[model samples]
Target: VSHEFKTPINAIEGYTMLLQGEELSPDQEEYVEKILFNTQRLSGLVGNILLLSKLENQNIPMKKTEYRLDEQIRQAFLSLETKWTEKEIGFQVELEEVKYTANEGLFMHIWINLLDNAIKFSPSKGTITMFLKQEQDSVKFILEDEGPGIEDDVKSRIFDKFYQVDGSHKAEGNGLGLALVKRIVDSAGGTIKAENREYGGCRFVIELPKQKDEII
Candidate 1:
């Protein structure tokens, strides 16, 4: 499997470097750039695959600690600033200062992936609202975007592995982001849900039990 993976990546890097150094016409450069971009994406996909493999084999370890929830979210936004900036999407943050216990790295991945999806589906120049509230027994985290809303038929199966929305989107994804998000949240003793916003676009709500209880 390692040989199977490394071969293509080595080939791509060799070809990409050749294309970059060689003198090519403007049109050819554009085409080569696309190839390079996609090659990078493939590299990232390979990394994700290796990570998933380690996770499946239970080789990954968890390090949990107590931290402020809103601060974690702010860090997520800062890390993902490029994605939002490129799309020119505005964000509405309504997070209150609250502390929670969890593996920060895992939750960072969860937020970036979820927020990236929200920003992708959101319309250009549209607003994405993030709400954090304390409920009776848990904390509610809501991320709502202003993109084309999810169809009723697909909503139920959205979290299923490799289940992309059929026919409407041709976007490049292995459809693993949400699935990973769901799994991580579940393992953390939290719940995640997605729905079409009443006004427009898609909304993802995650409920996490407060760390004070610790019983999960």
Candidate 2:
């Protein structure tokens, strides 16, 4: 089902990219960008929907692998170079060496989705900070962004599927990102929460069981 949707969306995005490279008036260029953006969004939405259904139905296996946690987070950050660089965003990453046994591919999505969310809401020339440490038998990860913090009322529902932050121009996403994050965390026998940072913006914390512990 996702492939059926993504095939056409990919073609539209490819054509839109070609249009972007062509000479055009400012207005035409803006229109091309809009087309490309929407097409890409549609592609992501399709994949997220499929992933959500798979997780919800327990169709995925409980396979686990031992991997370097810090490296995984760093790679996720590098993968989004263009997105952060476009906004002149700087990262202060402080990760400790830690290894954990888990489904590597599944956990990768958590970092990527969270980083993408942080970058999307970050201000121009802002700084994003990431911290990772082993707490007793578990690994703790934190990501802080410099953007508008969630409102008190809407904060509780941020992880609800299709729930976007209300009354903000920056709340334009399809809102599946955090919901997917929550589902993935549950599958890993972990807990994730969000809070408004005292300084500004939002902070996300994810705590996972020790490598020796049993996984769901």
Candidate 3:
């Protein structure tokens, strides 16, 4: 199914890219830009669906290794600079130097999805803060975003498959990101939770056990 849909989607995206390079009226350009955006979104959705399916079937193998946690987070944030910059979002990073043994590729999905959500729901010019603290035997990773906090009713199922707070299908995501994140974290023996901040917005906290021997 993924291959079948992605074939045509890729063709559409290619054509859109070509169209974008051509000269057009302001209205025509606007329409083309929307098409380009939706096409790229569809491609992403297809890829996520394929990945989640593999994860559910346990077909993806885990390659756990010791890696610098702070560096990983920094790389993820840098990768999404374009997204946050486009929305005028500011970031406050307070990452402590730490190392952990985990599946680096799978672990990256957690940071990417959480950071993506922070930027997605946050209002323009809002602030997102990330703090990494080393506990006695675990690491506490906290991400706070200045967005509309989750409702009491939806908090329980926020990580469930295909569960989107905005059920109108207007949002960019197909709702599999958080589900994937939860699964990956669980596989790594980590705990993740979401909470509404007292002051405003929402916070996602993840605690992962630290390995005794740290690999440089």
Candidate 4:
């Protein structure tokens, strides 16, 4: 199914890019832009679906390497700087230096998805906080966002595949993000959970075991 869809999707995306380069009236350009956006969104959805399938089948292998956890988080935040800035959201980061051994790419997805979600749900000009610390034998990572807290019922299934909370349907996601995050964390011998913060908003807590003996 993925192969079948890829051909036409790629064709549409190619044509859209070509059309965007052509001279057109403002109205025509707007329509073409919309077309391009939806096509790109569809492509992303397809990619996520294919990736989740590979993950579920155990077809993807972890490429573990030594890396500084704090640096990884900082880089992820920096990469999404435009998104948060556009939304006028502020950040409070308190990351402690910690060495970790894991698949750098997969771990990056965790930070990106969580940060993206926080930004998406947060009200404009709201603040998001990220706290990272090294616990006894594991790394504690917490991300909190100034958005509506998750309901009790939705909290349990938030990590389930294709499970979007009631109010998140309008968000630009097909609900695969958290599911992918959970899978990656599980593969790395980590535990993750979400809860409503007392002060408002939601918090995601992840604890990944540290490989103290691994040399970077």
Candidate 5:
């Protein structure tokens, strides 16, 4: 599999590097950004697919490390600042001082994918609210977006691979984002669910155990 995929993947990397070294218009930069994002995503896609296979067979490696969960999420927000700012979107973040033990690098994907969704379907000038805190025996995270909520019928299958909501934003994603999010959450012995917010828009909630190792 590696030999079969090497040539084309190298070509993608070469062209991407060329594109990055040049000056570009905002539109062209956006195009390059998408290309870069997808290229990186494609590289990880194979591993994630394999991880899915591991998940089915009940083999997942949990390399836990201590890190500030609040700082990581704040970095996710900062990383995608341009997208939300362009839409005049506002963020209401309430992150209590909380530390979590998990795969430090891979967990960032959870926040990035979810925040990208919130920014994508959000109305102009909308406010996206987020909260992360440790609660008793579990840590909780919640994100709410001011966009059209998911339809009840499609809600059940939203996390399925290659399933995109049938609407205007249908063309926006390849549908693996949420699926990957679910994979990481599940692998870490956590729970994640989606639902419609009471007033309007979408809500995603996640919970994870607070305790890790007794030796620590």
Candidate 6:
């Protein structure tokens, strides 16, 4: 995971710096800066994946607690503030003060992956809306992005391992993030899904049971 994630960032950074050094006009420099900024975003995503892999692979136990869902959502946004700013995207939160039980470290990855996807597909100067609601048996986490929505043909298989949307703006993902997210949520006896919203763009909705259940 580390190698897969870091390789692209390293390449982007190297080329971006090299490009930035050339005696270019203001417009060209702006273009290069966008490249640098995206590379940095990719770096952060890789970092999150590495952290998640370590947490999952290590035998060490995690501190499971009932944490505020809103805070995690905010933390995910806070961590990606730079990426959003660079893309000129706005994030709107409609969070319910709900709590869920999980290892904060592992649970953090879920939000990171979701938010990262949002930032990637969102249009410049677009809005990404997050909805967190508490249901009778679970808490619902929804993220909506304003980019080109996924096609219906790919929607059903999107959560499958190694599955990726093939089109323009489909960021280079190993297809592992969503698969890993499914695994983590399944272990917690939760459910997750992805679909194109009716209005437009892609939406990821996760429903995690508040009560603890042994992972099947």
Give the candidate number with the greatest TM-score: 4
Residue 93 C-alpha lDDT in model 3:
94
Q: Kindly report which residue stretches of model 3 are placed more than 4 angstroms away from their true locations once superposed.
A: none
Candidate 6 residue-wise lDDT at 70: 85
Instruction: Assess each prediction's global lDDT (C-alpha) against the native.
Output: 0.81, 0.89, 0.90, 0.89, 0.84, 0.79
TM-scores, in order shown? 0.84, 0.86, 0.90, 0.94, 0.81, 0.70
Worst 10 residues of 2 by lDDT: 166-175
Candidate 5 lands at a TM-score of: 0.81
- Find the 10 residues in a row with the least total lDDT in model 1: 166-175
Badly placed stretches (over 4 Å) of model 6 are: 1-62, 167-171, 212-216
Q: Rank the candidates by TM-score, best first.
A: 4, 3, 2, 1, 5, 6
- lDDT over C-alpha atoms for residue 209 of model 2: 80
CA shift at 164, candidate 5, in angstroms? 0.6
Please, what are the lDDT tens digits per residue for candidate 1 over residues 1-216? Answer: 743786788698778879888899999999989888777767756766665566567677878887888888899899889988988999899998878778887788788888878877788899999999888789889999998888888888887777887555545676777877887788788999898877878889999987675432
Task: Report model 6's TM-score to 2 decimal places.
Answer: 0.70
Candidate 1: which pairs clash? none
Please provide, for model 2 over 1-216, each residue's C-alpha lDDT reduced to its tens digit, 9 standing for 90 to 100.
776887788889898998977889999998998888878878888989988889999998979887888999999999999999999999898999887888888899899999998998899999999999988767899999999988899989999998888646443578888999999999989999999999899999999887665331
Scored against the true structure, residue 191 in model 2 reaches a CA lDDT of 95
Cα lDDT of model 6 by residue, 1-216, tens digit = 575769778987998999988999999999999889788867866764665565467643767877787898798889999989999998788998876667887777788877878888788999999999877677789889998888878887776765777755345565656766876787677889888888888888898876645221
Where's the lowest-lDDT run of ten residues in candidate 6? 207-216
The better-scoring model by TM-score among 1 and 5 is 1
lDDT tens digits, residue span 61-130, model 5: 6677888889999999999999999999998999987877788877998999999999999999999999
Q: Higher lDDT: candidate 1 or 4?
A: 4
Alpha-carbon RMSD, each predicted model: 3.2, 3.1, 2.0, 1.6, 3.7, 5.5
| lDDT score at residue 67, model 1, on the 0-100 scale | 81
